[model samples]
Target: MREFLVEITTTIPEGTEPAEVDRRRAAEAVRAKELAATGNLLRLWRPVGELRSIGVWRAGDEDELHEKVLGTLPLRSWMTLTVTPLESHPNDPGKADAAG
Candidate 1:
């Protein structure tokens, strides 16, 4: 599976009810955990003092990544998202070094 980097920032509209924000946040957390467990989501991180989040995900291609992954987010509508496809590094820590 190819990896993609996804960056998201919430865009909850003005005048939105607090209860709705809470509801979507709860669902978002649950969905994140579910995706992580399934290996669709590889890792997630939030920068200090920032409301944005970045996640690494595995998918066959951009279309599938959107349809099966990003499209399934509970908070998709409230989010401003950026997706970038990733290339695996030969020296990535997760893999052993190749011999000459």
Candidate 2:
């Protein structure tokens, strides 16, 4: 499986009520579980900087990732989305140099 980073950006429309936000949050939790069950969930980080939430996922390909994201309604509606492949990192801490 290939790894991907999925970014989600939420836009709150003018006059969007607090209850609506709460409802969307609840719905996102359900959608998260669905994504996890499909073996696509890796990690999700809520925005702490310029970008929105970052989600690491595993999928057969970009198409499958797009399908999964698009198929979920509230999530699709709330955020602008972007996906990029996670490249292999030779310097990854998990793969230390044997010579060391």
Candidate 3:
């Protein structure tokens, strides 16, 4: 599996209904949990005072990550994402653990 760092910024259109926002947020949480269970989503964080999220995710490839995983989000249409492909490092802690 390959890892990616994804930064997501969400923007609700002007005058969007509050109920709609709530529904999508709820659904997004559910979907995130499901992704984590499947080992696709590794970690997620929201920077203080920001309406955005950053996450580490795993996938077979970039296309699969975007099309299969991220595309499934309830707020996909409302989000702008910057995805960076990650390469494993020899000195990575996870690699050291496995070697030991």
Candidate 4:
């Protein structure tokens, strides 16, 4: 399976309160758990910037990733999504050791 990094950017909806931020976070957690159960989620993190959040996912291809993202309501409402392949690092010492 190939690994992908999904970058999500969201615009806060008008009239949303500060407390709604926490609610949205909770919703995201639920979505992550659901994805994990399906063995699609690899890792996820909320970035410390104006951009929304980042999710690392493993899947067969881009279509699968798209489907996964589409399944999340929060993502659909709040995110502009981009998917990119995570390239394996070459010439890393860890890789050399693992091959030995």
* Structural similarity to truth (TM-score) of each candidate: 0.90, 0.74, 0.93, 0.67
Candidate 2 C-alpha lDDT tens digits along 29-54: 88788878887787889866664788
Sequence-dependent TM-score of model 1: 0.90
Best by lDDT: 3
Per-residue lDDT for 1-100 in model 1, tens only? 8999999998889999999999999998899898888899999999999999998999899999899988898899888989999997877876654332
- RMSD from true fold, candidate 2: 3.8
From the highest TM-score down, the ranking of the candidates is: 3, 1, 2, 4
lDDT of 4 by residue, 44-76 (tens): 788775566687887788786777554465646
Each model's lDDT comes to 0.89, 0.77, 0.96, 0.75
Writing each residue's lDDT as its tens digit, candidate 3 over 1-100 gives 9999999999999999999999999999999999999999999999999989999999999999999999999999999999999998877889977778
Native-structure RMSD, model 4:
3.2
- Ordering by lDDT: 3, 1, 2, 4
**How far off is residue 80 in model 4, in Å?**
0.8
Q: Could you tell me how far off, in angstroms, the CA of residue 79 lies in candidate 3 after the best superposition?
A: 0.4
C-alpha RMSD values across all candidates:
2.6, 3.8, 1.1, 3.2
Best by TM-score: 3
| Residue 3, candidate 4: C-alpha displacement in angstroms | 0.9
Looking at model 4, residue 70 earns an lDDT score of: 44
